[model samples]
Target: MEIGTLQWYPGHMVKARKMVLENLKLVDVAVELLDARIPMSSRNPEIDLILANKLRAIVLNKSDLADKSQTEKWRRFFSTEQGYPCIVLESQLGKGVNNLIAAVQELAKDILEKLAAKGRKPRPVRLMMVGIPNVGKSSLINRLAGKGSTRTGDRPGVTKGKQWIRVGKGLEMLDTPGILWPKFEDPEVGFKLAVTGAIKDEIINIEQVTLKLIHILSMKFPEALKNRYKLEVLEEDPSETLKKIGVKRGCLISGGNVDTLKTAVIVLNEFRAGKIGRFTLDELS
Candidate 1:
């Protein structure tokens, strides 16, 4: 299986990092949103390290699109092995949001307690939500606030600025624009993001990404492609499988030839949107 590669970080990402750093002092904790399908790949390691001293909670957004059992495995893995509190959430349906306030309060309990002990009026736990582009940051904020409080679109770089959303009695959230690292050191991480729709398709080759996705699915979840597209699994040439999907889906040319490029887009879109089924591109062994 091949991982997708990404090149180029837009100007907005650079600006977002600075903005987040400038406002870091205002927040008590950080809620990092990650796509459940590719948790490791979707994370910005540099930003995480920079915010290391702050109380952090990982919200595995888009949990509905990922395998439920695997999601639980990841939750346990983060909590037990990594010592980070992790929650699996579905922003679209508003699932697992009620626990967000409680989780944040628990993670920042020490800070809150220390303030209370000093007879200082305990301030609301300030939380900053951060993540890479298109990782459901806005959607999660909207879900947490119980309304469409933030502008959300399918494309990346949609949340341009910062906004504070009050979640509960003593909790507030600062929504930050999505940020990507300066450069993707590991090409696999870039590819996973591209395959999962975190990266803009215009900057990437959809056909190439789709082929790589097919290769990964062929090994990790072979039945996913077979069941979703009803195409025969091929061990030798994966392009043949993509062509078969194109033929089945009627993505064809005027002369009745398979349009592999069109088929690639359909497959990639379906997989990213969960039409293919609940799946995770990466797994912990």
Candidate 2:
């Protein structure tokens, strides 16, 4: 069967995209956050156009949850290959965040020096956080400010408005609504976003998403699945494998059949929470 492109654009997201453009004028650079587990998919394609001609520092957030080797490769790809300053970050743990700070500073070095040369006091560097929904933008802001300056939640669109907050001695950040592109050119992008909880589960069929996830995981990291699910052997059929997992985890219905929905939910949440293993869905090779 042939797969076609998938697109998801809520009316609010159109407004969000416009808001991002309006707010971009107030900031010197954008701290674009990407989910480390699926770096490519997490990136909103419109971000390149949205942040054009401005300095950008890429923050691969949730680094602790991704394969270490793949994380390093992405860092190099962004910093060396793409020539953008990039840093790995674990917003939940405060790991590799100092480097993000350094990278931002490096991005604004010339502008700072120019301000100093003009006989004016260097002002706080205004930064904007831009990313697709549920990519940890709020947590990163909180981690930087050392306080809950913005609304932090586990779901997409938690930040429905834009506001400025002081984050450091010479840093201010603009938190805007998380914006997504109007259409996903590749179908896998939608699946990847769905798998990571960026897209609302209510809008997608969880069973199908979970099936795709299982298919990918079973092919790439079957050993991790084996250990996590306690399966002696994996079957070629991903549906069969998931049923075995459902039975092991006791997601059974009244008829003693595997409760696939309940089992799928568990698999997705655990994978997002990094219980299965450190994985990189967007591997370089």
Q: Model 1 over residues 124-210: C-alpha lDDT tens digits?
A: 787877788888777877777765333222323424354666665777777554354534667677788788887778878888888
**Model 1 residue 51 lDDT?**
82
Which segments of model 1 are wrong by more than 4 Å? Answer: 1-6, 9-13, 147-162, 232-235
Candidate 1 backbone collisions, by pair: 4-191
TM-score of each: 0.87, 0.89
**Alpha-carbon deviation at 62 in model 1, angstroms:** 0.9
Across 1-285, the per-residue lDDT of candidate 2 in tens digits comes to 112223454776778888788777777888888999889999887778888988999989899889999999999999999899988999888787778777787788889899999989878787878888888888887777775344322323424354667665567676553455534657787788888888777777888888888999989899999999999999898889889999999999999999998999999899988999998888886
lDDT scores for all predictions? Answer: 0.78, 0.81
Worst 10 residues of 2 by lDDT: 151-160
The whole-model C-alpha lDDT of candidate 1 against the native structure comes to 0.78
**Cα misplacement distance, residue 185 of candidate 1 (Å):** 2.4
